[model samples]
Structures are given as C-alpha cells and as structure tokens.
Target: MSYLRISDTVVETYRIVHYEQTNFLNRLHGGDMLFFLVETGMLSATKVAKGTSLLASLDDVVFKKPVKLGDIIRVRAETVYIGNTSLEVEINAFNQNEEVVSAYATYVKVDDLLRPVPVGVKIVEENEEEKRKIEEIKKRRESKLSKIADRQKMRFRTEDITEGIRYKISNVIHVSPELTYDGKIMSAGKLLKLMDDIGGVVCFNYIGYNNSTDYTSGAVVTVAVKGLTFYSPIRLNDIITIRAGLIYVGNTSADVIINVIREDMKGLKEHVATAYFTYVRIDKEGKPIKMPKYIPVTDREKNLYEEALLRRGLRK
Candidate 1:
C-alpha cells in the first residue's frame, strides 16, 4: 500500500439545524448530530479505502454543548489511524468556531462481497505533533481493546425477565430504500439515530414523563454514548427490531442499553449492534434534574447495572 498524509483523507461538511431535527427542547437532537458525524466519517474513511467503508464501532462520544436550532454545524472528519483492514476516524462538530461534540469511529473497508479488505493507503505523519497524536490514538485503541475483551467474557443466562426492568420500548421498522446508502445496506448514521430515539424515550418514560401534569415540562438529552459495536450489516428491506431498556439510574442521569436485531426474509434473526447511551433529564430551563431510582433484581439486570457503573467510572 502507498503512504498518504492524513490531510488527504479529510472530509468536511456543514449543515443547518432545522426545526424538524430539533428535540422537544428545540435543540439539535443528539442522534441527528450523531448521524451527521458518522456520515462525514464514513466519507473520510472511504477516501482512504478507495471504496466503500462501513462503520465497525463507535466510542468516546461526548456532547459538550447543546446545538441550538438554526445554528450552523461544521463537521470535520479525518483518518487518524490505519490498520490492516480497518481505520479510525476522529470527528469534531463545531458551531461558531467552538467545538460542541466529538467522537471516534472505526470503519472497515469492505469488498463487493461485504468482506473486510485491506485499505489501499497508509497514513504517514508529517511532523512531531502528528506523531504524538498517533501515539495517543494507539493508547486509546489499546485501552478499548482490553475493555472489549473483558466485556466478551461476561455471560448471563437468558431466562424470563422476572423483575427490575421498569422502562423499556421496542420498535419494528421496515428498512425502506431511502434508509440505505447504495440501495443495499442501511446507513450506520440512520441506525444510530433510531437507536438514540428509542433510548431517549426510555429515559423519558423512567423519569415519569407520563405522570407529569405538563408534557413539555422537561426533556431527556443524550449526554454521552459509550461503546457501540456493529456486529452485522442491516440490508435493505430487512425487518429490524430495535429495543431499548433502562439499566441504571444515577442522581441526574440514567443509562439505557439499545439492541438491534435484523430479521431476514427467511425468518432468521441476527443481532446487529448494541450500544449504551447515557441521558440526563433536564428541566424546561435545560438544567439537569434528579432521576428516579432504579433497583436491579434479576441476575442479568444486576450484571448490566454493574457494567454501567464501570463505564461511568471510566468516563470520569
């Protein structure tokens, strides 16, 4: 493979936050922002791959500031690390020259058969500063790998859920042609938006949204998204089931686990991806408020709760 500078793989795009894209708080929805980030990242990765690149995983997504409606969002994505067949893209979203959100995504170059293929280019650092950045990326990748290994070791019995799961919601959607990128596979950005939508609903329901006298008194906003791993490709016309369940609750925030399952025409169901989203209940003034307590009773629930705690500690 030939060596290429990181600048050669950079992609920048801009969008205006429309009213339809805003949440109940009249701010840009986290999921919509996520979609923009992932889409731009994919374009950057594709430039390096010289072909199609699919999202493999996303991590360390931080929402630093809320993007208001009518604000212009500038998104920049570039290939920061290159592996044999995979590359990591760092994306930053800015408004008025100030960064509001940032995320890191991993993409795998795939061939026509949807198999992982070697990326055609390698990244070459131009200066000492670039070299130091690459070193940091390597360290973060190593830490993430170690965590993934530990997570894979955890196993839980799949029995009937006896108790402790208070807030949960599931949605079944038919993957239409518009949802796909090439009329074959669904875009990762769309999938992430769907996951966040359901995750936000779970958080709102747990915070007694239905019991409140005023429906628009408060809102649930995404604070951060932990590790999101894509296991399979969602194809066009696939009947996908997205499920979101509340796992842990803190003083002002809660963690929701979202799982996506794809069902083919043959009635075969496959686990597509799983992600953990952290949401905070905010009052009408956008101030964070205390969330209701959640107690885990089942073995699975307890395990998930502990895992959420571990993730929270790592975030700090």
Candidate 2:
C-alpha cells in the first residue's frame, strides 16, 4: 500500500556499557546488548509501519566479542524487506571499530486490536547486503511462522533423572507491572534478559558439574542464539516458570534449550516461548577451551542430542 525508502526507516543509537550493564565477570551482559538491539529495531520498524508492530521472531544472533564496561556501543537498525503485513530488520552492534553482535528480526504490523495488518511500505535497497537479505526474507518469515505452529506441540519435560550428564534449572517468578509495557504486556527485552541469565546458569552448572572431578575451570559465554520464538505474550502478575538444560555438548561449546510456561486460570501450564542458546567455554584468555563429553542416556536425550547436532551443522 505505501512505499518507503530504507534510509527513511533507519535508526541509530548510542549506549554506554556502564557498570549496571556489566555482569559479575565485568563484561557487558549479552542480555543488555540484545535489549538495546530489540529497542532500536522496534523503533525503526515502527517508523516504517507508521504504527505499532509486534516482534514475531528473532533470526540467528551471534555475539562475536564481549562488550566491556566503559565501551560505547553503536547500534544501527534498518528495514531490509517488507511483505504483505510483515517486515525484516537487520541490526548490528559495534564497539568502536569492531562488530560485536549481528542480528536480523521480523516484525508484523498490527492494528489497535493487536491483529495483523498490512504494513503498506516497501524498503529501498541501498547496498549489497540489503539486496542479499531481501532475497531470503520471505523464507525466513515462513520459517518463523512454522515455528509458531510447532509451539503448540512443543513440550519440556520435568523429569529429574540424573543418570547422565544433564542439568536442569527452573525458576518461577511473578511478572510485575513495573516490568511490562502498557501496564499489562511484558516487554520482550525483559524476557530476553531472563532467558539469557537462565541459559547462562545452565551452561555454568553443566561445566562445573561435569568437570568437577578433573578440576577443570573456565567461564561460559553466550556466543549465539539460534532460534527464539515467542508463542504467547506474558501478562502482568502472571506466574511463569523457566526451565533450561543442556541438549548437546561439543568440544568447547554446548547448546541449551529453554522453555517458558505460564499457569492458566485453570492451573494448566501453557507454553509461552522456546529458545536455543549456544555457549562456549572460554579460558582466562578468552579462548575457547575443551568441554566435558556429554553422553546421552535416554531416548529423548538421544533425539535431542542428534537434533542439536543437526542445528550445529546448519550453522556451520
């Protein structure tokens, strides 16, 4: 319906990674960086759509290097492609001259009732990267939509079988009104922050527990988020539970699958979101180190292990 230039939809912002943004390890928190990215991308998309938009899905987000305190992060977002009612945005985070993170996200135009509506806009490609991303936008959007369908069948078992190298972390928290937008709906960035923290702890416990006998020591850092899908929006005061565990462990890396569920009025648990985060074991010098071997014990574990390998191969 409406045509717009990519330049007109671009948004750039600056952030100083201060002490509050840093983790206990003194490195910039990945969650904070992602929050910045999401905010910038959403702003840009809203400008192009000329109305509110909902983030449908997040593409492959890879964190190349750690953002340190006192570092200034330059975030840039641009609309790369537009569909009938959705658009793709490419976001990048830079620390000085080095690119620290890169991501692509899909957002859908929504009406006042929060229903999908036509964006009525077109993105004007201004570079080779933009052209290349445009060609794959449709495929990515399709894949994201498929994930939405898959979420209905997604399940996270709470089996506490400790017969193998497995770790599980669960937390139930109340979604306070202060953490939400419009005083009802939870912020996607806040959810991402929780996911990152839970996923990181899962990785940490996996490494610490598996290698305790060998006295192996190292730090775990999030390298990439493969696919994170939000099936439902969280509401204020809702009690939500997050469960995360390691599905596959490689030489110096591991893949963690996290599921978020909320309790309905009938006391039934409903799936809210699922995310896969890849973390690398890093030594004191920040180099990747070998991780403990993970042996699958159950049929479900075996299936998940194989699936994780397939996902890793795709990334390669």
Candidate 3:
C-alpha cells in the first residue's frame, strides 16, 4: 500500500532533558535514554514499513558520556537493513555536539494476529555513501551474531534457578490511550517504562521483603539493562500480563528477567516481549550492600546464571 525508500525515511528528533528525565544525581537516567532511542528508531521503521511495526530486538548499547539535565539530546535514526518483514535501524544520540549513546534495533511489520507481513516498501540508494553505509551495517550485524554464537559455545558451567532464593511478581493491566500511538498501537517507550519499573520492583522485593525484615529499610537502583527483545505488538486497551523474576544474585547486584504477555480472544497467553535488567541494592546512604547468595537448580536457570555471569564480565 506504501512505497518508500530508506533515503526518505531517515529520522532525526530532539528533546531537552528535564528534571523528570534525570536521576537523583542529575544525570539522564539510563532508562530514559533507552526509551528515547527506541522511540526515535521506531519512527524510521514505521515510515519505511508504511504502517505499524513491532520491535524485535535491541542490539548492545554503549553510553560514552554522561548526559546532564538541561542538555539538548539529538537522535538520528537510519534504516541499515531491510528484510521481507523486518527493518534494522541504527540510532545515535548526541549531547552538546558530542556522541553520547549508540544503539541498533530490529523491527518487523506484522498483521492483526501479530504475524510477520511483507513491508510494502522499497529502497533507492541515492549515492555511493548510502550504498557503503548499507554494506557496513550488514557486516556489523553478521559480526554481532558471530560473537554471540562463539560465547555460547565457550560457556560450560550452569546454575539452576530453583536452588536460589528468588522472587516472582506478576501484574495485569489495561493499556491506556495516553500510552498508545495512532490510537491503537502501544508505544515502545511505554513498554520500556513498564519493564524498568517491574524489574526494579522484583529486585526490591527480593532483597527487601524476601530477605530482610523491613521492606522500607533499603532501596534498589537499576544499573543497567542487559538486553531486551520484543516479539509482538501490544494494542491500546489490550489486557497485558507482565511478570518479573529473579535470575541471578551477586554480592551487591542482581539480575531480573521480565516477560510481557497478552491474552487472546480464546484466553490463550501469548508472549510479546522479554527483558533482562540489573539492579544494585543500596542502603539509605546510597551505599551498596552485600546480598544473599543465590543457588541455581534447574537446567534453564543454570544456563541463565552462567550467561548472566558472562554478561557481567563483559560489562565490567
């Protein structure tokens, strides 16, 4: 129904960081940056798809500089690759003319049932630069997949989830109109907010209510989001079920995996998204405290635990 090219779909947006977007330290919250990245990238994808698109996966992100409140953040998003039903976008954010954050993500065009559909679009490379950029992105995507495969093959040890002191929380909520775009599709920014909030709650409850006497005695702060992948789109007023559970616990840090599910007309549950968030437990004085040891039991838990360790190693 729509014919478009990447050259015409490249997106650029800007926002001024405000107090609501900053943390206690007056620095832009990692979650806020992530949400903005996805939001800006999705616009380019939608432009190319000529309609709604569902976010599939977010690539590894690196923040090079701290973004301060009142800074003007400019985000540029470009489509790097196009598949039968998907688009991969590379987005970068700059503050005060300096690059601060870089990320890439993939999204798919879908139908009412959330099944992949053809993106009615075409690409017209305008010049040699555009051609080279496409080639570069292709190689980068291939290199990233190769690294993931190599890491999996090298991993050996496994920790079971059942053996650990864990916590699980689930909530069902209706998506409000304000959280949606185009009067129907839920925005990726809202989904990120849900994940961050739920992940923090799971970590806090596991550390405070589950392990300590007074839940109000301490607090939990998100240090990073390991990864997040979306499988389907959530529509306005959709009944969504979000669940979070403890996956790994370190000396002063913990990892939680959150899943988003939606109920169909037949009452069947369908998974829409999954994300991993890392949190650090802090005392009233904002100092990290030692956490209880987590033991893994099941095979899946063991694999996740080992992978978490690997990711933590890479992060450090």
**Clashing pairs in model 3?**
159-302, 160-296, 160-297
Could you tell me which 10 consecutive residues in candidate 2 have the lowest summed lDDT? 156-165
- Show the colliding residue pairs in model 1: none
147-260: candidate 3 lDDT, tens digit per residue: 445332322212222233247777788888988876778888777777777877777677654544444446666666645666456777778877787888999988888777
Off by over 4 Å in 1: 146-164, 211-217, 314-316
- Local accuracy of candidate 2 as per-residue lDDT tens digits, 21-96: 7854578877788788888888888889988877767869999889888999999998888888887898999988
lDDT of 1 by residue, 216-306 (tens): 5477899899788777788988998888888888988888988887888888777777789999888877899887777887777888888
Residue 35 C-alpha lDDT in model 1: 97
Residue 109 Cα positional deviation in candidate 1, in Å, after optimal superposition: 0.5
Question: Ten consecutive residues with minimal summed lDDT in candidate 1?
Answer: 153-162
What total of clashing residue pairs does each candidate reach?
A: 0, 1, 3
Which candidate would rank higher by TM-score, 1 or 3?
1
- Model 3, runs deviating above 4 Å: 1-8, 111-115, 120-136, 139-165, 206-227, 250-253, 280-301, 310-316
